[model samples]
Target: MLLFDQNGWDSRTYLGGWTTLGATADAVSPSTGERLGSFAVATAADVETAVDLAVSAQKTWAATSPEEKAAVLRKAAALLEGTTEVLATWLADEAGSAHGKAAFEAGLVASEFHLAAATAMMPYGQLLRTGRPRTSLARRVPVGVVGVISPFNFPAILAARSIAPALALGNAVVLKPDPRTTVAGGLYLAAILEEAGLPPGVLNVVPGGADVGAALVDEPRVPVISFTGSTPAGRAIGARAGELLKRAHLELGGNNALVVLEDADVEAAASAGAWGSFLHQGQICMTTGRHLVHESLYDRYVELLAEKASRLSAGPPASGAPLGPIIDAGQRDKVHSIVTRSVDAGARVLAGGSYDALFYSPTVLADVAPGQAAFEEEIFGPVASVTSFSTTEELVQLVNSSPYGLSLGILAGDAYAAFELADRMRSGIVHINDQTVDDEAQAPFGGVGASGTGVRFGGHEANIEAFTETQWVTIQGSIATYPF
Candidate 1:
């Protein structure tokens, strides 16, 4: 098992001679208290070395033809598909995602890899009509080196989304996988990419903590920093990137709202909302943590939502469990703290509002005050807090009042009603009669305002953002066309 950093030639063939370095994070298995391998807490110097390597390697890699890049990415997709089980196992053990979900997340890595290959085939720049004394053509160039700072919640998929786009665009990448889940998932992936013929140092994965991230983002050679994590952290990173004059793409935290109108199918809405809100213990950025239900349906919806949450079974990720533990003790405490505050502030705990050991049962709270912690904060665990509103105007006001604008979901039988709800909700992505977390690889996924600064995915928009550039190509048909 190659640990920490890999040197390509020797590391790929060697299996068991890996050595651990730096202080290990308290990476407890969320399902059980099993102590997984610790993540190396990389220092500033480690980050500097990784960024330097990426910058050095990117110069040559960017010069390669797009066809060559496509071939390499295609190979990577195939390799990832072949190793799904191994990758899935790592994801389950480290991130506490259920086995089936872990497999799904790992599979997305391959899907995105394929998507990147497709994106590589896309033509860069465009020919414009010009009546010219001189002819000119423009082309986009790589931004050189990119620093990817990923989160622990969905390590494999989030890291792959950012890193794949960077590499596919011909920029070298320095990936800092979330320390919590680095060993079980990302390390395996770094090996696969290396074996799939990605140039040495073209893509490098460095496992580390917060200090390393600061170092990576601050480096002068790292021109772009892409981050997916909490709102506060995203702010800090955006500030640093601004200081360095580096391009920054942030997919930050969310307090997603799911509104169910009186006309909606109650049973369908209940099921979809439950799954959306509670999946991965509600740790996803797009998870619908808050529900603003129509007053007419609020009581019944809360009852059903609470019952569903109570019935959710939590266990080890390998057991084909429906739910697993929160990522770590810190997250577990954060969830608990939110619930405690809600209760103290007079919110009624409907069901399963307590935590034991690594597991916190799917929790549902009702009658929460608008300004309470549960109402205002991003309770990013398997906890659902519902509040009722009487009018469409009230629902819109409540949903838009939040600082977050990541995703908004609505459940309603009337298409027009759903459309109106979507128009009013303050979110970057909106779902109709569905879960907020449902995202297609081809569609752009991101948020606005504090939620994030930009969006990403593999498609025309992604290409424009990741690989395309704009240049005004001007030409003069005659010397008189040029004015002093």
Candidate 2:
């Protein structure tokens, strides 16, 4: 079956099944400045109703056999793989993804479903040793219901990373996707899973603004909240979830670094740096925001990077451009403000410092220092800030200065030296020879410090820990007498 259509585009939010209540909002194409379609805008009451249904559905779903759960997940994966073209189109129009990025994201989402299906058949728990004559064991159980809040940058992969595993492990999910990407992030999954034989109420999609997100977090029925967004918003959700005594898995923002040692090849390093900073318009959490090079090679490195950046053009993904528009005008303005402030702070834009409509050009800034806006802040745009470091101590200090530590990358001629430098880094993920923008369906993905809570979101072990609870049970053949 086809994944999307005109009718599905106009459908309401998925609560148990598709239904509308009250107001609706339009999903506009960020690249084209045209209305894609309208979806039901869920209110606080809709979030409450969705969570209640999830709670009710979790009881039956948790008791389902592992084989049955795996079958459904595998079917979902097959369905996703079959409709990659359609899904990519939705991603391009809604999330402003380039054609290649959109296709890669669709493929990754399908792979996550396959990995989650494998998790269903894996070992759940272990047996424990006991001194007394009794049987003892620890088994995994579902967390009942999970609340997922995904961002627009990576609408498909981010939402599917949590939702697929949560469902495969028998926990129902209530997802609130960003209004900007409601169809690709929220309703598309609902439609695919529904067609793949998933039971009603097992997965609910609500598309709305911050009010809907607050309602999802405040709902007592939701014990787990999985959020992927900005650092400020994550801190607010983490604090509120703590007050409610709930588990909040936050994958927040990052200002990652890419370091080039003196012995490294400036030409090759420049290419890697460009890919890290310009991929997906540099909107990813692990995007390389800071480029640190040895003082001897800084000028040449900056020149090559500027030349590379100038070759890239931004426009609608349908126009086959390498770089696409930012998510919206507000985001485009934020990018421009950061670049402008950095220029005023003595940083020079070597390549691009201009924008037209929603499309911002790939920009390279030189002479950026520790205190500059481009160097310190997480500029979620196609902007690369280049700085020079004199010694190893300065390099260490420069990389660790940022409060956000999501991913780090180092390039050098000597492998041992690069490994030594990587040991001093504080980020959760590190790369020795490659840039920082990377993710795998089976790898543990998250960050430390201001980036997020250390709890990760992928792999077999991490997924089990994130979505399930462990229970200890003991049994005896006969009833024993007890004194009261």
Candidate 3:
């Protein structure tokens, strides 16, 4: 029973130079169902305090050189590497990430900072190639204060993904992490930023539920909002931001597809499908929700995939299980609802659909046809809906039928053919020989339609552009000799 040290790691809110302690509820460990610790639920007043601080600090931060911001990010990354074990342990307990996945997230969080560090020296603005005597230049300026709202799925990595780039681009942030991940996500996350010499009021953390999140969004001082969560919530935020005419950056839900062509190697494809659909219990937005294979390869692929899924079990992070429980009972039940509804609608469970508390089995539903909830919706659990398609046109139609356009995966022997088909995918990202669940820090990562809004986040130049407002400057060579 690894309980938290109540004296040190208890409920708290980080306000630049100060910390506040008082929680509305306790954060429970998903694996053991034990109380990990409590976290302070930020009230509307708390949110006001944070926004006021950010508004004051951002003016100073935006004036600093990019190199100076990069130094702080690098120092934060070094501090993260030193605190890996402790953070990983708490993340596993609070978020229920498996040991390997938890460790991977910790490393990836550190790497996210490095990627942002590389962008520090890159061009923040561009000069036009006007050959005229007068000079014309364009500069990218920060979008003032950024209000960040992150989900609990990959607490450290997801928060870092948005925070690193925003900070690198000279934006002060007021972050509101989900209550479930307050300690693992907000506390240490902000502590590192503060210790790395972030000036007072540059970064603030208010851990709470919907009210705190809503307050942050409603505040007028924070002109930009970066949120990662479900589409329903995102839509609401989008509407509010629109009413306020504020800039918004959203990375939302996904119901991705994995297409296996007739010529694909069934064994390899099955292995990839298993890992993509089951990693972190399919909590990732990029997780494959549908597996569509050509009729000739469907049966064999299903067999191999089921066999692989059967070997996995959800347990504590240190238990060497391949996965872990869902975030909590409500989320666990939501996943099971899809499984039950699919079964009631005539889908056959080929592998596993049983649940012991929050640990949902890696379920595979066979012959899941159209109109089924599992087939049409985002079954964001360790569940894979397997079905077959005949022609290439049918495959394309099936994949594009869904509203989501986040990512696509294609497996085929003919490399060019795979790329050709992938090009037509409605998704923002497509992989010829890999699973849909993939990301790199340097590549542009975002989606079209409901999957995301605004520009992508990565180490690319686009990220800098996303968080910045552009201004064009022109120098007049001589006072007008024209008419007057």
Which of candidates 1 and 3 reaches a greater lDDT?
3
Stretches of candidate 3 above 4 Å error?
1-9, 21-24, 129-133, 477-484
lDDT of 1 at 248: 82
lDDT of 1 by residue, 21-109 (tens): 45446555767778755545556876676666777788888888889998988998998898888778778887888877788888888
Better of 1 and 3 by TM-score: 3
Note the residue pairs that clash in candidate 1. Answer: 1-15
TM-score of each: 0.91, 0.98, 0.96
Report every candidate's CA lDDT. 0.79, 0.93, 0.85
- Poorest stretch of ten by lDDT in candidate 3: 1-10
In Å, residue 18's CA in model 1 sits off its true spot by 8.8
Q: Model 2: per-residue lDDT, tens digit, 126-185?
A: 989999788999999899999999999999999999999999899999999999999999
lDDT tens per residue, model 3, 145-238: 8889999998888788888888888888899988888777777777778778788888888888898898989999888888999999999998
* Ordered list by lDDT, greatest first: 2, 3, 1
RMSD of 3: 2.4
Number of clashing residue pairs, candidate 2: 0
Candidate with the greatest TM-score versus the true structure = 2
